[model samples]
Target: MLIRNKALFNKGLMLMGSFLCVFVSLFLPIWGGHGNGLDAADNMFNRLSKGSSYFIPGVKEDALKLEGKSVTITVKVKDAELAPRAVENLVKAGATAEFKDGAITYSGDLGKVLGAALIDADDLFNNRGPAVLERYAATEKNAEKTIVKAWWAVLDPSIKELQKQKLIQEAKVVGQVNKRGLEPGYNFYGINSEKVLDNVLPLVGLLAFYVLYTMWYGYAIFDMFAGIGLGMSKPKTKSEA
Candidate 1:
């Protein structure tokens, strides 16, 4: 009955449009926004349980495989120097890890492996990963600067945390920026999400639409109800006489 009238129908349509925007946003290709990293963080355990090795990229002879509640993760470092630390990290992750023949292998509870992988991924985004990855990726003259720059670019969306790590002197980052042929341009994560559509927009948009729809139709509905009440209160017409 409420939607029978034109005004009420239009209000209902606007309310539905708002919900449509929210529904579409969920599957939209938003790279970074709050949806990518923070939402992932919130559902980390559930995501892990579903068995996606999101943090680790590529397939080594040893890849992190999840089966039931078990997990196996392998980390390969370009520098043998990083091997010890890699194993140590896995240990901290509650995995039985061993570093031998240039790679570290971790096997244990999926939760622990995933937790460690997430920590390492965050560490990478925070500059620790990029700084180290570029060293292996760079070989050409002045290529180190650009390669690292690209990695840093991917990590740039999370720059606030990178600044706090202090493990690599800020001076080095500055020096790399000044190096010749440095053109940072990789966005591995959802870096463009905020400009187009943000995760928070859905909830906020839904609320705004509901409020606006009420503003458009609230009085109209009340008026209809009031009219009905008044009709009942007054004498009824005798068969349309």
Candidate 2:
């Protein structure tokens, strides 16, 4: 009885261990969150259809590729009072800021600009330090927002137009050229289908592991039941009888 009980306990432990391993494997990747794949894809598509506003001359085309592009955009603004406001606008516009060496460097997307605006407004009332610094900071913050907004607004409209043009071209090519047996030309840009698939691989892998874990647990349960059945099936030898 002691030995059988020990064996049962061991089996239970083995089952628990297997279950834990499977659970950890399935959830570990999910805990890391869905990476910036979707964002990167959007940016890539935007860049492909409409040129990037931030793209500088001499920057390698390959560098612009979404495979390893950084989502952060950094801008420097001078003024201590402006720094806080600038940071605020940056945050509103979906950005972050750091004050360094008399300059506030803001990094983010369109949302960051809104955040900077908010910061600038707040500083107007709260800033009480060096008047010179405060005045300059306020001016700098406003200037930065105006410049950024103008550039982005201009680029935004152009991008929309470019997308429209691309769509029309694609439709014409597909409907007329392809039908006529000429090679169909489609503009390839941004994140391709393969990349999207790759992005989902982590999620898929997690689900696959979950399925595997279920199978393993089911087998373990069956094995335990089989052991119990075998123990019951053994004929009892009654020596005293």
Candidate 3:
């Protein structure tokens, strides 16, 4: 290529080399030598995400509004073996649960039953797997038969049954409890929890690096293009006739 602007070409090369240096450093444990920059950022976000996913408290308020409301619903479990465990969960939650005709029929206060579910979800969310396991009298040997999954099996059918009975508000509240409360607990289980305030410095540093890195790339491209005489130029103004 012809040497259009040696100064701009050198500047571009310098910026690219510096960018590569930072890129390579990202793979090293530059963040306190405990983990690479990328890992640190990933862990920080995971923790922050878990911290923000605490919706059980709000769901509890809505669910408890269903206090003294009795609901009789039969929920089917796809896995026959797990039906009994789901029964145990509801029964433990102050509900009468019986497994018959290939389904578990529950009868009890709606609020109390949902309250028990929220407690289990809270335990799982806090990484207290033993608490949930103990609640269901289960072991993790099968992994699939965990208490959380059993909650899902029961909650799914319960929601449908509620909707069928035209208890729309009850159905919505139960669905919200399952989705916002239990789902987050299950999804974010085992992730570290952190407040944004506690991680302000690192969060700020990561965000700043992102902005600078993006701009660094843009500047590199702009300089390289300008050096090669490929830069955009302003169009000549048209003379008024």
TM-score of every model? 0.25, 0.23, 0.80
TM-score of 3: 0.80
Q: Point out where model 1 deviates above 4 Å.
A: 1-68, 71-78, 120-193, 197-241
Which candidate model has the greater lDDT, 2 or 3? 3
lDDT of each: 0.41, 0.39, 0.85
Tell me the tens digit of each residue's lDDT in model 3 across 11-75: 98899889999899989987763899888788889999888889899999998899999999987
lDDT: worst 10-residue window of model 3: 139-148
Q: What does candidate 1's lDDT look like per residue over 1-241, in tens digits?
A: 4334555445555655665565466555463545643354334333222232232332111123321345344545555654555455446656687777865565666434343343334333333545434434434553323333432232232123324544233323323322211121122221222221234565465569568756655554454444444222566678865
Q: What is candidate 2's lDDT per residue for 1-241, written digit by digit as tens?
A: 2334556656855886778775565544443445343453344443333322222221222212312211333334433454555455445445565656754444444322322332332222222123323433436534433333332322223223424545333233222211211111112211222243434665466569668878878766655655454343667898995
Task: Give model 2's TM-score versus the native structure.
Answer: 0.23
The candidate 1 region of ten consecutive residues with least summed lDDT is 178-187
Off by over 4 Å in 3: 28-35, 75-85, 94-105, 141-145, 237-241
